[model samples]
Target: MSPAGAQPIRAKSRHHRLQEHVLETTTSASLLSTSYLATSPIAQQILARDLAECSDDDEDEVKFDSEDDGDDNDDSEEDFSTTLHGGAAAHLISRPSGTIYGTLRPIIASQVQGSPAVNERDLAQSRREERSLLRDNHILPPKHRRPFRESALRQLYRRIFSTKVHESGCDSDVGKALESSPLLQHDYLSEDASGPPSPSPSETDVLWDCATVASSNILKTTWQREAKTLAQYSGPLILTFLLHYSVQITSIFTVGRIGRKELGAVSLAAMTSNVTCYCVIQGLSTCLDTLAAQAFGSGHKKLVGLQLQRLTYMLWLLLIPIATLWWFAGRILANIIPDQDTAALAGLYLRVLILGTPGVAAFESGKRFVQAQGLFHATTYVLIIGATLNVLANWFFVFKLEFGFLGAACAVVFTQNLLPFLLFLYVRFIDGMECWNGLTRKAFTNWGQMIRLALPGMIMVLAQYFAFEVLTLAASRFGSADLAAQSILVTCTSTTFNIPFPLSIAASTRVANLIGAKLTDAARTSAKVALFAGCLVGLFNMTLLSSLRFQLPYLFTRDDEVAAIVSRVLPICAAMQLCDSAAAISHGLLRGIGRQRIGSYTNLCSYYLVALPISFATGWVLGWKLEGLWFGVTIGLCV
Candidate 1:
């Protein structure tokens, strides 16, 4: 009070000390006491001055908070500083405080000087920054994110749909969605929690992808499958006809060497056996082949084996009746062939051939199963084997053993019957598959399905074979030379049509399986390829037949009269080859589509209603003779 000019050094010193204390205190402690420290530093000084000014006019005494535990180290420091400035030497040292004192001291100081308010604001700012960082890092809330993810998926589906990728499979839109978002993986590896990613595609998958060209390219381009199909089927068709030609030439040759009686018996026996057996064998084989194709395509190997077993039982049972009838074929032949002497000759051939019925039936079953695997080349090999055996056996029995017509029938029996057994054993052991698992009671129960598939084609085959046989019988009445010439021409026509038959079969199997397996693109491509293959085969055979017209007569006859007659009627035969080739291929295509009934009906209408009547009329009433009958066949074929 005496040092008037010194002017409030005490207040200034207090302010300076307060700032230094605050700077040293932790912001964590300040925040804990933020509620109690709402005033600014300068405002607290004004409040203290006001309290001092009010001391003179106070009626009541000021209350001191004696409860303050006397633990104010900061306040003591201020007092000691004040005393030093007043020319007194005083020193104070602080003792270490207890836990409560340490905790509360900073809190109390923060409240007195508004340090808590600054700390509270900093803490709030820190909380906001944390939230912003999380948002920036893609840790979005469930409600705000799910719809966005779903929208992205929907857009992806739309893009695939627009690109025509959905045409690749059945319910393709769904498949595409599943492919993108694999549900099966969800159970094993949760997408929500972080984990390692999926590995790269496998070698097989990569190869398949690389090989899979666009559907457009597959449709336009011809593949080796088609070329192989042409080679495989065309050869068999030609061979079937060639075999028929061999029968006719053998008849004429035998007649020239032996007599008409012996030749007639052999020719009738060959025709009766080949036509009847060929229909049953091919029909059943087609059904079996189609089944195998479906099973293979769908990856149902076990089911295929089971179905094959069923077919085996059904085939064996069916053969029982056929075999029994053929066993008594010697007696039946007396009425079928033209003369009693020819009947005796034909009966001997039939008796020997009938011995091979079981073998032939089994062989056909095995062949169908193999061919169904799209191994069209198998047909060529099997045919070659049979042909070789037949040729060798014929030479041995006829020329060496002097077995006559019985020798030829024995050759047919030995070769045809043995082939299927060898093929079955090879396919089962070497190829490691059971194409013929044999008959069981379980197979019989499933035979209804097999019969459902087999019957239409079987009936169609029977009708066609019967019509051809009747036409041959009628032509035989025109004279032996006319019969021989007609046989050669018919054989040529039949062989050419056979080439496209397998192509049709492959198409049916592939398309049906692809459709069943939900591979729409593959199915469509298979159908187109088959159709193209059919057309190409027809065109090629037509070209071949046209070029070979002059040489056709030399194959079957040395007689100038027969050659001249064949040359006169060759145009109709050529036309029949063209028409029949297309028809046979188309018929096969229809069968592949499981539309065998439609093909059967088409055959019925083409052959019976049209071909037969015209053939009879031209041969019998019109007096056009063999040319007229062939012309009727040509017109009937067009119909």
Candidate 2:
């Protein structure tokens, strides 16, 4: 064969390879546009540019082969091929007479022949044209054209739940899909490598947005899978929350048996301790959800221990003031309460509780530390032992030893202190020791970040807790019968809350994990399942409370008046269960989306602005008493 004859055959082979490459690229772009590119301006621009380049090449091929073809029929076939392969590109190419592809193709080709500087200039020009095309097409919004300034919180979340961790796992179908997706890999790598220009911050945002959207659509998660995950998480969590709650309720059961005064006093003391101390401890330790979990997830194992220590120290220091308040609480209660005897007994219970404050602090912080390392069962184990001990101690001290109301307080104090010790033994002897560094001086330093996160959490918790405690205080104004009945209502509602609250936490965990994995649709699906589960739990609680309304009060108190008042108000409390569960689960959903501030604001406004005023008006002003107070609470939960 002559050299001229050889040229056409090589050209034909090159044409076939280019055609195949163009076909694949076109298919990929179509799939991407359908699933992901809709959210990504930068990706859309790149695909458009590639199509335009292919169109230009086809036009050049047509021009070159036009003279060789004898018939008009061959020219028409070439035109149809051009339109079929790059219809959008043909339209785009025709609109821009001086398209970047027309000018840069020669330079890009020449760069393979070693003209580096001209190729660099041509590449820069190509980028500018891409941006212009993006803007003209209205693909990139003007506001988003500027550098995307990520919020500090979002940046921190990304850093904590980085793609490196997900890539390492590749556990789920979604993870495997992400790992296997060459289109996504190419888009991500192109920005990092020297071949393509790095994307601007806005473009970077668009790229990730595309990936997330595409992954969510392509890898659809089933409702059954989400429900199973929720069940796994919530089952143990429900038991743990219930057992932990039972520690206080045990004291109520023992103390309530003595008399109506003791029952009201126990309720008053429990409310006071919870609002002033336990809620603060829980809230401050909430920082560990982010801090300790981030540290553990990022593989800084010892930082988890340091966080725990710092939070524990903060709590112990805060305890000094809390203990003082409890010691003098009797005098404070005496001035406020209509019944001096009940106030004195309540204050005595608070004073006894002061001994257990440090233990509560340690346990709360330690619980988070272990949970951050995925050691959820450790707390459950400790609570099982602690709750059982509390029950037996309550029975022995109050009944066997005949120590009266103070014995229930003693039993509570013993259990509260014992819990941290039990948790410590588990951590030291069991699974979570890897994250525990020995007590260090570093724990005392760098308190600012922890405190900053803690204060807002504390305030949010206080808002919710204080709202309920205020209802307890308001019921006191109605006298011992109403207050004791209020205690039963609060206990029943709180016990039922344990079911849905834990379910919500489970749902939140599932949702947050899905969001981190960029499974947006899956996260949304999980949230819906959680809400549905919450509704079911709420219905169960409602049925139980309403059906056993008369009998349920006798379990707490033998007093005829208290039981009568409780029976009258029990149905109202049962009616609030659905609303209560929905509210708790909704808050969990908000937390999952990193929009907990919205939940906090809503809680504050609904409880304070909506619920309390109505309670005050109906309970006191309209003489509806306990029933009206709960009606207000029900209204608040609805909001």
Candidate 3:
């Protein structure tokens, strides 16, 4: 077929056959069915250019054929096919009869061959159809819309005042915003004309259904109902269980590191710092929880801002006393421990812990505010951040910093302070809620509410602290070892008993909100749920601690004498959880009803007037050592 001396092409040699096979495999599938993809308007132009490259040599022939046909329709078909293979023509030769060209085959031939154009067209068309369907279904378009800042602000106002507009509206920004909002807009009718009547029955029913759906959406994933709320109790219970075990282990390990005097000092400092902070934060934060929950449940939006402002006032007031005490805690430590060195260390611990007070309190407030809006996951994340910081700081300070008790103290402060600041910042900037402005200027007005909430709770905590101090003194008369063992046992209890803290917290808010909204049945259901859950958690903790009784003392000491004494008292520790759980849950329920005074009185009677004296009498007068003392305290716990 060539000019001169060229033989006709024949079958390939073995090597040639291999070469052909390799080329066929190497050719891309994309090039084979490209014509089919060209049906898309965007792809159609691309196909035309590719087809021109394929028919470059036959362009004149095509031009002549087009002229003879005297029709422009054939020219378009020629352009399309030629454009489709433009990139492939340098290497590909068209098969005379088949759709495929030289050295190439379709990868998905069966899928494309019957109606290759239809196959690709359908795929492209399907995507368009889907987009069209979405639009037709009334989906919001993906266009930038103006921020509804004023609307959000107004809504926030309505949340606080709920459109009541009592007291004839004051000159305050909140009052002004409330009065100007469309929610409060009620057009007056002219004397000559009457206004339209309200909606008919069918319209009312439709509105009711819409409202119900919206309510259901808010409650769907939340622990709001009887079944779901109760089900949620199990997770927090298990998490608390794990945390308690870890805390107990940590206390025992810490006490085991040094002597009894050191152990007692550290334990006292730790308990005082933690419980004080807990009382301060929780007590002040309770108001936010109550306010936020009421605001949310009743659909009063601006109340969130007011609640936060009120909490801020309480926090600032409490901060002064706490900060002052912390600054001078070392001087005061002398009276408690009677050892200059131990007292100094306790004072240092107090000072270190105080550094985190503001942050910790703020964090607690933010958490309660978010949680009252039904954000459980926010609480979960806050705990996770605090716990992670706590563990990391403990490891670094104790092991790497080599600061011992001081390091542990610093670690606690670091976590407590950091989490609050972070949470507060997040709530302000990123939470996207308009009411976040409450953290700004409005926080000054709610001082009265915060003080009222903080005073009782702080006093109660301080009383508990004093009671522990007396017990420490009583235990000290038995010698340093007895004091050390008692300190370790208390740490173990702290860890174990903390398992119900979250449950109590959840119960307090859940039940309180329902009660506030007059959902008596729901409130009762939540109480039962919390009670059953707390009992199960308490039982589980009891079983776990009892099972590990023998090894517990060893974890806290290498001294055989001290370990033996502690091991004997392990049974008493096991029984204490039962009383602790009942009291803790009862406190929670009472707290929900704003009866914290009841909780304060109960703690005073049980620990101060009862447990301390019994411990001293049995350990000293009865000559039974630490075991007898613990047994008496357990009996006091029971009463």
Candidate 4:
């Protein structure tokens, strides 16, 4: 059977391994059965390419010769031996017996070995199944997702303030927006962290949980509870501010009766000292608001007292520079006041005023410290006594003994000193001393942190007040008639402003507490409610001021000319009152969250950059007089 130049026949077949336990079909025709990855898609692709290239080969007829082939209907044995290897490689033995051979592989061989027609539907179905299996096994492809820590602080605030208990939550988103704010965010407060201890069930705000409160009775109960809680803190707080402002009003009232010159001089002096020293002190004191409120809210009772003491120490140290400014107010008075006599008297007044600078720091620190711990009533009690005593002293010294302007200054200084003395006694003897650890060395230790907080606070509060003093100074340049009218208007507006200022304090304190206690949702709700209430109160004040514009001036003096001047400026004052109220509350909110820097920038832009230029342009350039000055104030507030 040998012949010269004979070609050797070649045999080829594909091997496909499969997972034996698979319940469904796969792309590779069977589940791969191997410890390693049994199906290399790359190998399958190469084999497919080879098979396609060889498929066109001819002289490969595969037919079996059966013995019983006489009848056309007789069955013949089928050959399962030949496998097309890329249509190029096929082996057939040239045996003398006329036999053929091929490999019988599982799915691959059965699919294409002898079949002339391929069903694409079955092939596609197999491919889909294989892909699905690969996905289930998670081979090669990795998924991407955002980190949960991004909004950690926001979620944390919500959980802390919410009365509703949650199994798991992300609460940091709300605070995430402010996380980058240096003044508000603490180093320890991680956006994705669990901050201070969450408020206890009893401390949690029930109003916040009223989303599920279906019945009328339940809603009523919740409102009553929240209202009572708010009143307990805000009532005495409001009264305290009212009484304190009454002290200043008493000084003005006593000074006003002496002479118009004295009234204007004292008013200018008060404005000067306030802007240069007192206002800045008050702003710096807010650091206590942030620290003590949270410390108390989180049940860190001792920390509140320590922070209070720290603020006290910090303020006294700051008073040195402030007192120096007050010392030179008389010389600086010429910068604003055109009258030589008034400026000279104002100088004497500033010299006398600087004596009370330390007292101002002490008084403000004590008030904020006590109030932060929820001892609202204590503040009211102390302030009422101080205010009453100041009025009595003012009457005796000014009218009874004729000490005049000096009497007014002395009485105010005494009253300011009285505030801190009373608070110290109360803290030493009263029920609210739970948080006071009694002035420790720790107060002096963490001063750097306190200074950092105080600077922004001072700037925030300073911007508006400094601008107001400048406005008063601008009024002084308008002569005694304008100054006296401005004096009356300023005093009256400030005294009446007590309404919204207390609400602002309540808002800030409540927010700080809720935040520290981890009552995040409650903090947000409280802020919204406080702002709404402040707007309502402000509108009411604006209406009252507008209605009494012409009539209210007689309370201070019988001077028809001054009263007429006040009437002309009343509209501007009325408008200013509305913006002022809102701004005051916003200040409180900012202080609560330790965001004083933002408030500072807001005030700086509103007052100096926006309001001041317009006021000067209108008052001097356009000759609108005192009305222009007041209008500028309103503009600042609106801004």
Candidate 5:
């Protein structure tokens, strides 16, 4: 209880504090080292040795603490030195206590609290190594996948749901090592699990900032990649759509050369056919987009053929009633239309078109069949051969053979039937036959689900097609000149639309792929690029229409009155191109994200509620006519 006793107690207290500090520092440093070292066999051995040394030092301290109280004050420093120099921990902390806390303290401090540059470099290197290993093992991060060409619908479902299986050996030693190591599991292999705990506010801010920078870099690099991808997908689609639509356009061109009345009649007939037959067939065929793709994606490859057969059978059955309507179309047209000659001619065109109805049905269903299997180029090839034959047939039948207006109808019927025949040949011999499982009674059985999906799709197509057709029908009331002009306008606008429409499809596919891969930022960037491309396309179309307004109409009609009316109205249609392209791309983006219902609703409301009514008001009531009709469409697109 005297000064000598107090002095020993003070020295013991100091020694105790030093021991505590060393223990705390060593434990923290070991944990930090373990994080980086766990993947390496050599580092793991060193960690084990260090851990064992720490345990021995703890035992030595316990033994020292339990020693007799009278003999320890002079021996305290020697004991401390002995503890510090005895094992791997002592070697790690080689400096004497008097000079510094020992070498391990400074190294640990430098790692934890020194320059961020060194830490960042090490962290970056660690990440690079991890990524390299993942790549070597064919283990992609959940947010990324190797790009490949696949069906858009398939990509959408597969990517979004993470249903795609990689062919890599996930049972490899690297994978096993990754799975066993807690640190590696936490960092790389656990993303698909419940994920890490939510970061704190400050941590979240830092993460967000880092993500923003990363996203910016990704955008810069991926923009060209996405654009190139879209181009590859869209190019053939554009040609296919144009060539298919040109079947109708050729009819208009050939018949228009006959006279104003014939031009007007063909326009009316085409509109009627689109509304009653083509659009309905197209809409119904949309079921295959989901059905065939799903069946193929689910590995039910035969079901794709079954779906096509089912839809085709349904369409053929539906064609019976449609054929009846077409047979009586002349009489039906005479009752509603004021121009009897135009009506009768249109009716004649429809009657001839009825011959092509079965072909139309076959081709529409067949397209989805091939497309679901990522055979988009198949349709393009068919259309190329078919479209060339169509142009030649129209020229032969209408002019060379001098079958006149009737020859135009004949040409259309031949081309219509020829398209399916060509597509069938492609399927039978070239490709897409893998899906076909021979005609089965199964096609007759599964009509209900197809009908349900078909009806909505049909309605979606009907809504858009019907609106334009209605405008054409309305133009009939103005006179043959206006009707002919309307036909030219419709043909031109529809043709121009093919550019952006195909681009939209490509964009939708890309965006859906990214979204399915769980790359939200990448998807967003792709959408932006698509929209920008749409804008450029819109601008190009606008410029073309505006500049070539006068020249373009003459291609469809020889009638000066029709051409004059078309030239006057073409600029208004041109102005609508920008809005049209933007809307198409926006819808594609929405579809990519599985929000297509929103697009469908918007399209219905915008056309029915905003566009059609305004068109009627301005064109009919306000007497703005064709220009007013298009003005309403422009406004609706903006909405």
Candidate 6:
């Protein structure tokens, strides 16, 4: 018999007769457990042919056993209840690939010496008897519906093995088995055996988990199982971040072209005005990223949309303080800066950028909301459109209209504000929005419960990004030439750093989704896949940037000294890219698992308590110039 479940035929005439008889009996059987109509007249012949082959194999096995060893061949009677053991494969799924099922025979499992040599006839008979007994008794087959649970199926397999061993021809087989009950107990009994005395539940669970993981998709290649999940989210995630960060970079470039003063003001505004607002609101919205993903996975469809609505409201209120802070940014900067012009312009630009504060909060919150629902491509599409138009708006307002710094800030406001509206429209109209209900007062509630997660997530994002900007501040003391070079390098590395941003989002969403769906094995597999993918992407970025270190500086600056400094520092940044990517993805994994606070606490200690001190000490005390600052930063990233 072939392992694909086709047994060799011993008698062609009897096989034909048995096939017709089994088909007649199966056709007349009623659907029991599941709902379905009778099979069509056209499919009856094909069904009969498959069932007939199954019965032929069964009868042959019965006859072969009867002839070879003298056990009850059990041939003539048709007991339909026999199929319950393994016959559902024939009556259930109709596969186009022509794969057969329920053809499993009792495997000859005994290894004891002195046992009779099993011949082809015995193997054939064993397989045939299992199949025939499954289909023969006229005890009404189950309907085409839900399959058996893993525990029950595992028990069935155990029974099949036990039965096959006992059926062998050796007289001492039972005695040999009973003498080794300890070994049998190890395999069959749970560790914490109950009052009835059985195997431990832990051992049973382990067996079932292995079996369940093994049985997912028969057609999916073993190598493809883990990778397929990574593929689903990684590509869209990369594209989304690419489009997203482009909007910010374009804003920087458009205003940078205006003048050095305008550039400085916008940079300060980003640090002071936008960063706080953007990071805080976005971080808080990740509360939904974790919650909504689990909710969707757990089958609470409405909860996902409601969570989205709730986050939108929460962020709407969260942005009020952020906007007010930006309003006073210029005044705040004036106290610290020796140059009043730079400080006042910084304040003015922030107020302008604040024009889009609600937009940033809304869009970022909406992004997390839809992303949790696995609607990644929608975010990508909106970002692409917003990014394209943002460049044009920046060019038109800053260069064409001579709006100066305000022109750059206005473009940011318009682009960011538009994203949330566009994403909202998509959810309302698209297929995945089955969870979205119109807004309500319920969204305004859930303050304390949601804040528990939101607070840690907000701190995690702020601590990491804020630590990075500190490196920039530390570079400023090295003189204007070093500062400009550091700025270009930071921009380049930031863009390069975005390669892993998607992976983080994907990891976060995928992990939560799997956990909510009650698939812990799949969730663990996803984490492993995400980690491996992060490594690959990090290595690729490190190699690419390192190779382009000399030439890439020209893309960012025309100044020889600035470009030269960038070229020198580029390698350090490249090496750190790998670590940075891993850190980012790790952050996402933590968020996905609803453990953002651990990462938050870690970053606080690593960046402030460790990394910053190292940078300050190395850059100033050791006088290693810009390299010292980054080296210190890299050391912190390692931690």
lDDT of 5 by residue, 79-130 (tens): 3322332322100110000011001000000001000011223333323322
Q: List where candidate 6 sits over 4 angstroms from the true fold.
A: 1-210, 213-232, 290-310, 338-340, 439-453, 477-483, 504-535, 582-604
TM per candidate comes to 0.55, 0.66, 0.55, 0.59, 0.66, 0.60
Among residues 3 or more apart in sequence or in different chains, the pairs in candidate 2 whose N, CA or C atoms overlap within 3 Å are: none
Instruction: Kindly indicate the candidate among 4 and 5 with the higher TM-score.
Output: 5
C-alpha RMSD between model 2 and the true structure: 23.3
Lowest lDDT 10-residue stretch of candidate 2: 107-116
**CA lDDT for candidate 2:** 0.63
User: Which of 1 and 2 is ahead in lDDT?
Assistant: 2
lDDT, candidate 6, at 178:
30
Better of 2 and 4 by lDDT: 2
What is candidate 6's lDDT per residue for 270-320, written digit by digit as tens? 666534776677557656654554344323345566667777778788778
User: What is the C-alpha local distance difference test score of each model?
Assistant: 0.47, 0.63, 0.49, 0.55, 0.63, 0.55
Residue 410 in candidate 3 has what lDDT? 70
Q: Count the backbone clashes (under 3 Å) in each candidate.
A: 6, 0, 14, 36, 2, 17
C-alpha lDDT of residue 87 in model 4: 16
**lDDT digits (tens) for residues 183-264 of candidate 1:** 2232212234332332122221221121221122121112343344335434454454344334334434433344444544
Tens digits of per-residue lDDT for model 2, 117-213: 1122332433343343223222222222223688888788656543222233333443344335544433332212133444563353333334344
Clashing residue pairs in candidate 5 are: 159-516, 160-516
lDDT of 5 at 199: 35
lDDT of 5: 0.63
User: Candidate 3: RMSD over Cα atoms?
Assistant: 30.5
How many collisions between residues are there in candidate 4? 36
